[model samples]
Structure formats: structure tokens, C-alpha cells
Target: MSADAQTAGSRRSSETGFAARTGGGYSGPMPDITIVYEHPAWFLPLFTGLEARGISFDAVHADGLVFDPADTRPPAPVVFNRIAMSSFLRAPEHPIFFAQALMAQWQAVGARVVNGADVLAIDANKARQLALIAGLGLAIPATRVVHRAADLVAAAATLRFPVVVKANIGGSGAGIVRYDSADELAAAVADGNAPDSIDRVLMVQEYVPVRSGAITRIETLGGKYLYAIDVDGGGGFDLCPADVCLTAPGKAAVSVVQAHPAPELIAAAERIAVAAGMDVGGVEVMIDDRDGTPRFYDVNALSNFVADPVTVIGFDPHDRLIDWLADRIVESKA
Candidate 1:
């Protein structure tokens, strides 16, 4: 480990978001964990972390991934899910649903799936996330849900102007577009310019001017608060904070920094995680610039921690995550 990552080992307790230590490697016939994922680049850091700890893991790329019902034995004792909802953006034939089935198959036979199928169902749908958050008596953006782009115009009538039409199954900011006027939205629907989700569900939401031009993303693990990062996109909607995204050609830069959330904010995030069945994920709440109301809009099952951990956030969250994974390996064997 470099000095930056090594610095993380010294800081214990709350700053690291986990209490366990990286109990080290696994030497078993089957690997300790199997990560089911679709994206090619996102899990590089995680793979590196797992390997650094001398842990055993298997990476199953979900694209064109298949399995049979006859198979009873699991490849690993613990399965970690890494499938992304925005997978459809990279390829038309995405594995978002296939991943759910695969993990369900694993879980049925007693494999401990981190961020399993139940959690993926919530991660894959925005409408479901909003309802789940609202059911907890939490605030969310004023929005309308519909199954077709044509209905978006009608839905717009119920919401304020300058609203955004978001695909219910979206990620990395795909399938989201903002319209300033009702006519603009109507024209978009008329010209077939409005966005459609993989699941064909759409949400016309109040374009809450992001307070302070940024939105805060709170990460949780094991239904506990891990850490939060405020992501600022400088007026861009594709505000994904993963470092690899920053290097994409022609993409505007985003600012990512650690945020020490209040007790209420942390509690609310934790509640949403538990409700969503998210073993490891993030909950996003943007303070409505209009009235300073914190509108909880998104709950993500995949948390690619912010870039440059040591300098930006004082420690590498990945270290603690590895610690948790190591513990899981120990648990599965016991």
C-alpha cells in the first residue's frame, strides 16, 4: 500500500466507517467471494483492494453471463453484487435483471450475497426508491410517474415548471433531461425527444435547484452510515463522482469532497438503506434550493467511493470495506 492508503490503517473508529480489521487472506478450494458485475472499469479498485489483503475472490462479468437451474453448488461462499443500472447505456442488452436472478439463485443455496437481489430491485428503480423513502415519512422531490413518454407532458401539468424527465432505471445520469417550459416538454414528447427508461417508466420531477450547486451522497454499509460526499457538477446533470468518469473525454469536471452529515441526515440515510434491503450502497438527498428542504431523490445500491481518498477524505474507505469483506469471509466459513 502507498502512503495514502497506509495512512488509513492508523485511523480507527468512526472516521473509517467500520470497526473490523482486514483479517487477511483466504486459502480455500473455493474462492471467498464472487462479484457479479456488468461494468468493465468500476470494480477495478475493489478488486485491487481484495487482492491487496490476500483475499480470494471471483469476478463474474454479467454481460452474456449465464447459468443453469440444475447447478446446485455455489462458486463461492459469499457473493458480492456489482451490477449497475446504467448498464443499458453501455450495451443495449444489459444484465441488470439477469444479475438479480443469478444472485437469487446463489442466495437460495446459502451463499451470502452482499447487496443481493432484494437490494438490486430497489437500486434498479427510481420510482420504487421514492416510494420507499416517502413511506418512511421522509421528504422527496415533487414528482409524477408514468409508463410512457407521451404521458410525461400530462404529468408535467401536475408539477412545477423547469422539471426533469428521468428514466426510472437510470445510472451515471443516463436517461435524464431537463425542460424549462411546459411547451418545451410537450415538444419533446411530440418529437420523440423525451427519455425512456429500460423499464419504460418515467418521472417528471421538480428540478430543485441543487442547493449550493451540489448534491450530497451518503454511503452506508451493513445498514449503517459509512460516509458522505458532496458532488458538484457545475451545471451538468451527469454528476457521477467516480474518478474514472472524470477522465472521460470532453466531460466537464466534478468536485468531490467529504461531508460530515448531521445526526438526522445520517439517521435518515440509514433508515432508507435498511428499508431498501441495501447491504452496501448510498442514499442521495439534495437540499431543495427553493426552500432548503432536503429532497431525498435517489438510493444507490452501488457506492463507488470518491476519488483520491487520503487527500480528499483523510482515509481510504476501501480499506474499511475490505475489512468488512474479510469479516464476511470469516463468517461464511463459520
Candidate 2:
């Protein structure tokens, strides 16, 4: 790792798992856990894992902005994390920044935060994450991060028409649009860049034609590969039921095959997670039909698997992920 990366890693590591000491070193303690989640249903696996392990954790809604460390509610020696804050869920408006501040303050007071602020900030920026992924020698589609429609149009021309225009902060197919003709691409970019719209810049890329079947979702827990899910999707951009998607590769120009990606792709995910400080995170990749290279498109630091684990990976990821987190907690203490 470069000196800058190493320095950033060290700082992030300390922030995520260490407790400050009066004598200037660090101390360890039992991990009092606080879960930040909005949907109880989606977090069933986490809750199940915690319960199965006999660990008691306080659950906090992600929408809250005020947190008092002094309250008898949650004690120290805790891991404060809300895995649900990923783009899978829409970020609450107005208080989002303040909510993050409160969480950081709680951590400052004593709690160890898994997937801490540094990690979250880095993972949230799609362009930065993609650049890092590409830097790690992963194959990524030709991409252009642009603030204006003209730049996007130019990039499209360079990338050769029918590019994918996506919001820089988008996820789970949100804010994703495909434009076949130059006019269509230009119109989409104009809408995205309009003042009344989000006004957020976009990341445009040459849409890789993926084989139909499934897209691979690889999760890394503490720099270790956990599991991959083949996300079978509709032949087109829309989402279809997993069963339907897995039946056969659709005839769409770009089909979705959500399966265990190539070994190279898994390695790419590992590198990304380690660099992004995601002890536990997921990376999404699509097999490019043009050259048959698995090109990375998304990195999610906070992720939960709701798909059928037994059919997808031949085992339950909940058990594996929780076990890894449990062991990492002990290892961190050590």
C-alpha cells in the first residue's frame, strides 16, 4: 500500500475498532453492540445472528438525529453501526447530516464503530470507489464522471453511443438509465442535470453486455471473501424474480447473470473491501459480453442478503457473516 493509503487505513482502523486510553495507548473491552437500521424485516439475519450468539444489542432507527451518550440506554464498549444506510435504502432528507454527526459523537465518546464514518464516506462516492477498484487492476467499463450534460454527451460519443447514465450516488438500479441514440442520451443527461432535478452529477459508462443468468455479489468480511450471490434479473434493466432470472439467459442485449463471479472478480472485491475499510462489504460485478471480462460496477460497504442463500451459495451467509463478525470482534479486542 502507498504511504497515504496506509496512513488512511491506520486512522480508519483505529476509528472503527479501538478505544482511546488515558495513558495514550488503546484499551479493549466487551463489544456492546448498537444496530442502526430502519427496517426490522430486512435486518432479520443480523438480529437472528445476534440472538443465536446470545449477544444483546440495542437497535436504533437510522432516522434519528439526536443521541445522548450519557443516557443509561446504551453503555460503552459498543460497536455503533447501521448496516442499512447503504444505497439500498433511501437516505432521509435534512437530518441525514445531523444524524451522522450524532453517530460520530457517540463514537467519539467511547463506542467503536464498525464501518465507521471514514469507511462510509469513501464507499458512498461511486466515482472514487470505481477509481479505487480500477486502480486495483479490476476491469471496469469505460466511465466518465461529469457535472454537465454536454460533458456527458461528449463522453458518450467517445464511448460510442448507448451508454449507461447513472447518478454518482445511485445504487440497486436506482437512477440508472440506458440511452441507445445520441438524442436519447442527451435528453436523459439534460433531465438529470436540470436545476429542478437532483442536480447531482452522474457517472456515465459504456454499458457492458452481460450474459443472462445472474450477476455475482461477493461479500468480504474483514478482507476475507465470504460468499457470492448470483442475482438473476430481467433480461432488460428492470428487476425480475430470481427464479425467473435463473431459468435461462434472456435475449436482451444486456442480460443479468447474478452468480459466483470469476476468481479474478472475487479477488478484485477483496482488494476493494480492504482498501475501502469495509471489513464486511459487498461488490457487484457484471460479465462484459464484449470481451468476456467481469467488469466491476458497484461496491457497497453496507449490505444485507435477502435472496435465498441455500440455493444461491449452497449455505446460509447469515451464519458465516455473523461468525466472521463475532471472531473479528474478539480479534480486535486481542
Best by TM-score: 1
lDDT of 1 by residue, 22-139 (tens): 2212223667887776666777778778877888766655543556555576768898988888788888888888778878888888889999989888899899999999999999
Superposition-based RMSD of candidate 1 using all C-alpha atoms, in angstroms? 8.6
Model 2, residue 108: C-alpha shift (Å): 3.9
On lDDT, the leading prediction is 1
Query: Root-mean-square deviation of each candidate, in angstroms?
Result: 8.6, 9.9
| Candidate 1 ranges beyond 4 A from true positions | 1-28
Clashes of each: 0, 12
How do the predictions measure up, each by TM-score? Answer: 0.90, 0.75
Model 2 — TM-score against the truth?
0.75
What does candidate 1 score on TM?
0.90
